[model samples]
Target: MLETGATGPSAIVLNGGSSSGKSSLALALQSELPGSWLRLGIDDFIDALPPRLVGAGGFEVEADGAVTIGPAFTALEQQWQAGVGAMARHGAHLIIEDNFVSGVAAQKRWRKALEGVTTAWIGVRCTPVVAAEREARRGDRIAGMAARQALIVHEGIEYDFTVDTTNADPTTLARSIAHRLAR
Candidate 1:
């Protein structure tokens, strides 16, 4: 049975752009926070998408690292977000990984979905240049995406707190979030 309304925060939203170390931070946070926390992010959903919808049906990825979501992609994203909300409602502690590309609108959607759940929003910030460097080193992300999203992703969401990975390591950043959760 899912345990609803347990003590402390039941969900954490890590909002940042690609290559900002959100994934690493999530992992570090899992190690820092007590109990089990689930990670749900755009990557998870994107990976699950059918090949037909990956780059054309619902989403587009330009060579310059720009991404556009079509109507179909938007529809799928809604379902994914809803499911994450359901998981929270069922008492699972969630670590949501996202880039609020639509700015405030996207954050508002998540806020509404998680209205009754105790959710902590975290802004993961990294200077575009630094993020680009990280991206190049990682070798998995599309080039230039980090620079493209570094600023726009955090546009209008107010975070419980923000973490800068530009100089800090994931473990250090994770501890800060853990401290917030402890309070």
Candidate 2:
């Protein structure tokens, strides 16, 4: 839902379940666009958090033992806003990769955070089997398959474009996003 007057190269945000090629596609888009675009990953913020601050499984567990992602998501939104601002200032496009599907409330919070930004959310659609296999291969603290499945459901409702990446190459997916931005 971005308008033409957005004043940037149509920012792309890849939001999807774990192991759904969000990171890969974002990185590919960054490479393809080169100096004209910037890629930001939520993992970069999550992974850099102090170890003790992040609890079991490390998917933004809050101090209340609840699997809350508000803090991390706030950080991501702040970063995304900054990136958009920077890109607009420098006349470049922006791409952000994130698993923003914590819950309905979480999505609402993110929507509020993005009110002023010119952004589009793209979901990388993949089967549960493929998602699990990719998550296992990636070998990160993704909680578990059930958690990933839950995330997929949440993300499915929050995307503008759902690209099935089970058989597509990362670069091709990136091109599709780029084409959207270009249009």
Candidate 3:
């Protein structure tokens, strides 16, 4: 559990495989957690980024079909870290939802960025079959699921809490997170 003092809200990272409900989970955390929690989605950061940095061609598509973020990851990370710092100064909890693929490197980065705050990672798991179905229903782009899954396979193991979102609704999941945060 994160310490709830004058410093800030507990910080959490929501990440997972395709269709694992990461975005929805983060949105819920913003409301479920006490006080006001700021959310930083890597997608939003990337989408709003200057076109110059994104470049014409992006990262190579892995065999798993995941679209790896190119140099944009660096920009997003910098912005996210800055946001976390600012939020901490204001005493706000931060919940970041993004597909930060890779390994131990990311864990270290998270630790450094969220220093002095309660921190945890929530990983959602869903089979590829389930992923595809949800993608269709969620109106995801043609390649979004595969890209998300590839990133998860590369990064999910680093998380502290792994949940299977295949059966849980957003409210149920939010309640579950709230229960945990309360502890």
lDDT of 1 by residue, 1-183 (tens): 112244668888899999999999999999999899998888998998877787875877789999887778877888888888988999798899999877887888788778788888889999999999999998988899999999999987798788999999899889877876776
Clashes of each: 0, 0, 1
State the lDDT of candidate 3 residue by residue for 1-183, as single tens digits: 345444334677776655667778778767777778778776676677667655444434454445555656565766677767567656676777755565556656666777776676777666667677777787744555544673455452565556776777777788887776565
lDDT of 2 at 165: 78
| Candidate 2 lDDT by residue in tens digits, 23-138 | 78877887776366667666676666667546544345433223454465456556655655555445556676666555455456445545555667677677767777776776
lDDT of every model, 2 decimals: 0.86, 0.62, 0.65
TM-score of 1: 0.93
> Where is the poorest 10-residue window by lDDT in model 2?
57-66
The weakest ten consecutive residues by lDDT in model 1 span 1-10
Kindly report the root-mean-square deviation of model 1 from the true structure over all alpha carbons.
3.3
Better-scoring candidate (TM-score), 2 or 3: 3
| Model 3: pairs clashing at backbone N, Cα or C within 3 Å | 66-147
Candidate that scores best on lDDT: 1
Better of 1 and 2 by TM-score: 1
Whole-model lDDT for model 1 versus the true structure?
0.86
C-alpha TM-score for every candidate: 0.93, 0.72, 0.77
